[model samples]
Target: MAADLEQPVAGALPVKRTFLLIGTIVIAEPLAATILFPFIYMMISDFGTVQERYVGFWAGLITSAFFVPQMLMATLLGMISDRLGRKPVLIIGLLGSALCVFLFGLSRSLSWAILSRALCGLFNANAGVSRTAIGELAHNRGLNQGRAFSLFGFCNSIGYVIGPLIGGYLAKPAQKFSWIQSGNLFDQYPYLLPCVVSSLYSIIVSVIAILLLDETNQGISYPTLTGSTVSEETPSEALAEQDPLLTRLKVAAARIGPRNSTWYCIIGVGCVSLHAIIFDEIYPIFAASAGDHGLQFTSKDIATSLSVMGPIIFVAQLVLYPFLNDRFSSLGLWRTSAAVLAVVYPLFSLLPHISENHQGSSRIVQWVILLVLLAIRFTANVVAYTSISVLLNQVVAPEKRGTIMGLGQTAISLGRAFGPALGGTIWSWSLGNGLPPPFDFHLLYVIELLLALAQVISSLGLAKSQSVYL
Candidate 1:
């Protein structure tokens, strides 16, 4: 057992190349999941499954299938990742995912699409595995795990943004492009192009991963038992501090949750993750909905909003996340992010109201405000997510990192699973409730706002738990 404590030095790890490779691999899973967002309603409508009134609920179900496996099997995969090498599991997951995306794009019925998506979910374990691998690498190299995981989160946001961008443009490509061969496969299956593109990337990533990913897991023999553990503060960084803001955080956070420990950080992560995913899945649907009860946004509008959000979020993750984490407690970052969302969601709900009885410059002003708020919201999400991930990884022992982080992944998957499914059902209900113009969608935002506040309360509980302030 003591021999297991001795780890090989990271002297020849090719850290930079490994960073790029793992980041790419992690991006593919999310890209596949998110690429379906913009065209989901259209796909369901074409399937002729249920009434138009239930499109939101059903679209959400298809999306939820991607997460269902994570909730059920992430921990198992993570444990397997510990026994096997991270590289093989990663490669297999990516290759399997590519096939799933292609099948999903080609599905002629809702049942087929659902099965393809669930298969995609069941096959991929990159999210949990990557976190485990990154945590292992950082421990070996004595790197600040926060900055490393921030890059992982940065890669994550890129996938979310680009997936939607591709889905918006490449979906229904036969009509979008005039030069395409008419009456061919593209015309027959309009949404297949984006799926094909995503699948190709997955294939390429799988090949690169085979050539590049080092075996980060040392596979220590656990003959008796295994348990989760939180890594202690390294000599380079101290959890205890004398900063005024941290001091304020200590006092203000006196009643939030339990002490900042393994599962405690996971709880905070679970809440924030749920919030981010709900926004990701619901935004596209809301934007593409008809104006009667929905946001009345066109595909172009949805695309443009995401386009603006992409660079801002990317830059913030690259620049602002590390900068802010250096200055604030984890609880501090969580509270601030939740507070921002609480404000932004209410204003977002106001857009429908702004459209009615407003014209020209007034309408334009509302649009500009919405974009600015959205940008702020995106920045907050990146910061909070990166912060919590860093904390979650920090709270586990290096040897058991895979299983513990996998458990964390399962909790997060529950959020991802619940977010879209519930959001979609409620959205369908809201829009079809026969309420006035803004009231229907307005209810959705109100619910989001309250959840956002729950995040704030959660941070407070964590603070009061007297957890490690980092």
Candidate 2:
């Protein structure tokens, strides 16, 4: 082990600009959503009048639509990055994303909204590119790979925290402008302000990236474990001679077969996406409904809850996760936390029913239940996500990092896309005559149970799979 540690690992080409490139992209992509989400329901409601119960479905789609295209395109983007240095690809993706944000501001119909978001997905390769770029940059700079990944996660959490605050406050005009009525401007032009802000941010960040970010795909030159040296005659030729391991991994992941890491990750992330769809996509609807049971919450209140959630998540990632990971393996953390969610998510589904059924009781009961639900879900999320991230960092080889990371990103996007639709469909189904109060409770419970089972399976599979550890 000591000899292996002494062995000179592949050295990455030092690039200071890589940090700016990574940080800017890391901050921009999530900012697009955080700023836009506060007014998503308003956008949907503005587009069309939705039934009270089905509102969750509409809100859920806002998230799902944005992610689906990214999910579909991640592998291709990863492959492209490997072939054509990361900078050009990053520029194209960011430019496309900026265009999408502008288009989202201009969208006047639901179809247009969907189209714009899908386009954003297609171009939103920032996360994947940054991950690949940073990994190479880190290796070149002689930085620890796990630490590099942790830095990305840390920056992401910070973005998540700040973005929502910007959305919650900055996106909204105080008392409306001179020509616009107090609330009419924001209500009528739901995505207008936020989207514009997002576009400008993307453009600025992209410019910085273009000027500063250097290409790391100079021909590979490194000593292998077997004493063989790897290199390319020219940087251009490097693409054609990429390690076979990356190719095999991509082939394995992209296959329709259910046994690969892609499938497990897809299923795992899909389960998590469903809850996000429920909590984020559905919660606003429930918040709106709070008045019937006297829990009255405005859009601002909902925004506040979301904003708080982001920071809390950031703290968990930064302060709590390292300690937790020290005690529990990623798979162990995933299984244990998922088991908690299996129980907690369904109980959460019952809150609205309690509010509706016990109308004469104090509304504090419902509020307490809501808070507890949020706490449990958030805790589970912190534990499960950090574990997965650490595992992703540990599992694959440096050469295949780009493709593997993209695979995970793609799975997340796909899950995020479909999750809302599933939540909405279930919510819609449960609102009918023969069902129990808060009709969707059973569906939420069932989905979570299925997810827990999949988590267990994934844990076992991951434990058996081979990995490279530093």
Candidate 3:
């Protein structure tokens, strides 16, 4: 019994509790999002009275709104965690997230939904704080950094897998639940069930964290680098006296210099994220619209098509990425991924065109083309997701990981917010006043090409800059 007590807790945690916490946070939001995604078009049709063409556009805004505040405040939240502790941030984020989920169920108007989404985005930095806490824990246990990140990725991937599947299955039943029916009982109330589930998950995690989680940030009192001329209190003492949350945020942000490799890496990450946003925002709409021309598929078919890419991504991260990272420079991976993405968008544009023009070709040819496009898109996703996060990890120090990740999250959020609006406007324009078949495809290809160019420019810029790690 004494020997059991004497054994360190770290070994036990990675096997059980740590993974559970990470898995809960990762899976809950995505599961909720997935449930809503399949139903989004239905809700927009019922509630917003919008056309099918605009479903993706409006859905993008709503989804992006949920992440905007997270992106905007991610750096600040991370910095705060660095100063005072990760536990408080984790608690606050989970609690706030749950409230936001509840409000989402309660929202009566589109405007109310938007407001609630923004608020949820504001405190959604729980993921970053979790990463920082885990990183610190890993460091203390003498675990490898890459492996730590991979473990975190694995937890999130599991969530990604379960979230969509559950969401698709639960969409209709959630609407009929008694409480949701009594309130607004609209056609889309089914989405409320997933939100309820997510909120409960958050509350449960918060309770568990409050009891079991410790202050893993152990180096808060390291002297500031601004030459001991000023008499600032030690970080630990300051944390003790102040509203530790806000004070720590301010101090950590102040310490982070603008011109460091970390900032450059963040900029690069933001640029890469922009293309991802645009592609993701645009693709579903494009796929759905294919129904109008020659391609036949429902919105659910589109969801399943995209969902197939998730496992492809998992395989790359698990089997392909480490080998690629070892054999080639991170920059090499970035360049290769960008090149493939740049070429593939134009090919995607050709799919519908071939469907219309190929008189002699069998139906199998078109399906084959679509399948190939999905494959290319899947490969692009694998490369981007794995490579960017890995490179970002290498550029920043462990102390600054949370803040930097917050900034990266913010960029992604901004992309989500704006990308759809931009794509919708373009799509709306291309479909304008009776434009012929393939016009939307042409417009999308043009936008994707521009994004590809932007990625290339950013990659070149990254190459020229001195490697922070090397």
Candidate number achieving the greatest lDDT relative to the actual structure: 1
Question: Which stretch of 10 consecutive residues in model 3 shows the poorest summed lDDT?
Answer: 1-10
The lDDT for every candidate, in the order shown, is 0.75, 0.61, 0.60
lDDT assessment of candidate 3: 0.60
292-341, model 2: which lDDT tens digit per residue? 32234556666666666665666666567656665655667767877877
Model 2 stretches with alpha carbons more than 4 Å out: 1-20, 49-54, 137-146, 158-188, 216-271, 290-296, 353-372, 437-442, 466-470
Would you give me the overall lDDT of model 2?
Answer: 0.61
Q: Which candidate would rank higher by lDDT, 1 or 3?
A: 1
Give the Å shift of residue 184 in candidate 2: 10
**Residue-by-residue lDDT tens digits, candidate 1, 1-470:** 11222333323255766777888988897899899888887888888767877988888888889898867888888888888868888898899999999999997788998899999888765688888887776655556656788778888888888888888888888878986678879888888999999999999989878876677764532221123122233311222231243334335345443234666667777787677787788888876776644456656567777878888977898788877777876567878888898888867766666666446776687678879988998888887777777766655655578988888888788888888888888888987788874557777778788788877776776555555344
Clashing residue pairs in all predictions, respectively, total 12, 3, 7
| Model 2 worst lDDT window (10 residues) | 219-228
Model 3 regions more than 4 Å off: 1-20, 29-35, 51-53, 105-108, 134-143, 154-164, 173-188, 211-215, 220-260, 290-296, 353-372, 433-439, 467-470
Q: What TM-score quantifies how close candidate 1 is to the native fold?
A: 0.87
Off by over 4 Å in 1: 1-12, 220-260, 357-363, 435-439, 466-470
How close to the true structure is residue 134 of candidate 3, measured as C-alpha lDDT? 61
- Model 1 / residue 167 / CA error / Å: 0.3
